[model samples]
Target: MIEIVARNGSPEAMLCPAFICDACRKQVMEAGNVIYAVRYPDQSERETSPLFVAHKGACDMAVQQWLAANYPVADGWSDLWDEIDDFLAYLGGNFKRSFAEDADGQYVPHVVVMPATSPKLP
Candidate 1:
């Protein structure tokens, strides 16, 4: 999961997490990158599953192909096109608004972990 937070000493600037693309093995640094969570049949008992983060164009396509080939159910996969700034707004915490502070008064970044599968998928 990627953590989106306001940069230290610069509330107007956001510090976004960078992930390595599972398909292309390249770093995905931008806000609009894609993230995929895949769950296999035998690994259901695990609490935290693996995640695949990739760039928008070719890397995302490659991830799609890999998921399709490995997990044919389609229901076993969940993906999101992450837009950091917009998501922060939706969470009621943007760069302008103050983030939630911990007991130590440290700013808490918004962290979302999507489920690997949804019942709505066919």
Candidate 2:
């Protein structure tokens, strides 16, 4: 069944998939392109854990970029770039916080990059 996740603050996904690391998850076998995913901290989880909520705009940009690039209508993907830039702009204009080291002292918002892997075992 398809699960529709609304508002990343729900309790259903506490650990919140660590998908936010600015990395691509899948690679195109034919063209060497990529598929990407992002993650944000689930508010419920953050209540007990040290995770931070991912900016919703980051998630939206990732989705739009994928749709624009992969869908049948490939020519219109330029807007995705604009959207990404817009997000960055918003950050620059609105927030003044910066990323800090985590408990293990590793850079956080740690980009958890998973290289494209083989097909799933069936």
Candidate 3:
């Protein structure tokens, strides 16, 4: 997975590997758990490793998502694992972006905002 550092909650590339993998896993302090996609430029498409499971109630949902990607549905989602509900609260709270395809077969969701803090900003 490609790790990005958010600028005021927006995504940015990780400067170095010094940061812990846990660092890559952002905590949704207020939002609960951020659910954003992260695309690894070099890594081939694959599901999240089962071994990385945590917060089973929440982690279970993560596992389900990883499984869905491994087995895709062209029409739409076939199965909504119970774990999914556990993660939805944080879907927009915190996110990681990537160019890799999700179950929908696209490079994750993203869009520009109206500039929060800027000098006559873009």
Judging by TM-score against the true structure, name the best candidate.
1
Writing each residue's lDDT as its tens digit, candidate 1 over 51-120 gives 4555667766776665554445455544345554454466564455554543555542333334345312
Clashes of each: 0, 1, 5
3-120: candidate 2 lDDT, tens digit per residue:
2223446565443222231223221121211223333344222111111112234433454443333332332112212233344466586466434523444433333423234212
**Residue 102 of model 2, lDDT score:** 33
lDDT of 2 at 5: 29
Candidate 2: give the clashing pairs: 20-39
**Every model's TM-score:** 0.39, 0.21, 0.19
Model-by-model lDDT, in order?
A: 0.48, 0.31, 0.33
- Model 2, clash count? 1
Better candidate by lDDT, 2 or 3: 3
Which candidate number maximizes lDDT?
A: 1
Candidate 3: tens digits of C-alpha lDDT, residues 1-122? 12344434336544432111222253323222222322222345422221121233444365446534643355232433222235544444436633363455555333322212211101
Model with the higher TM-score, candidate 1 or 2: 1
Segments of candidate 2 deviating more than 4 angstroms: 1-36, 39-82, 91-96, 99-109, 117-122
For candidate 3, the 10 contiguous residues with the lowest summed lDDT are: 113-122
Model 1, runs deviating above 4 Å: 1-17, 37-49, 74-122
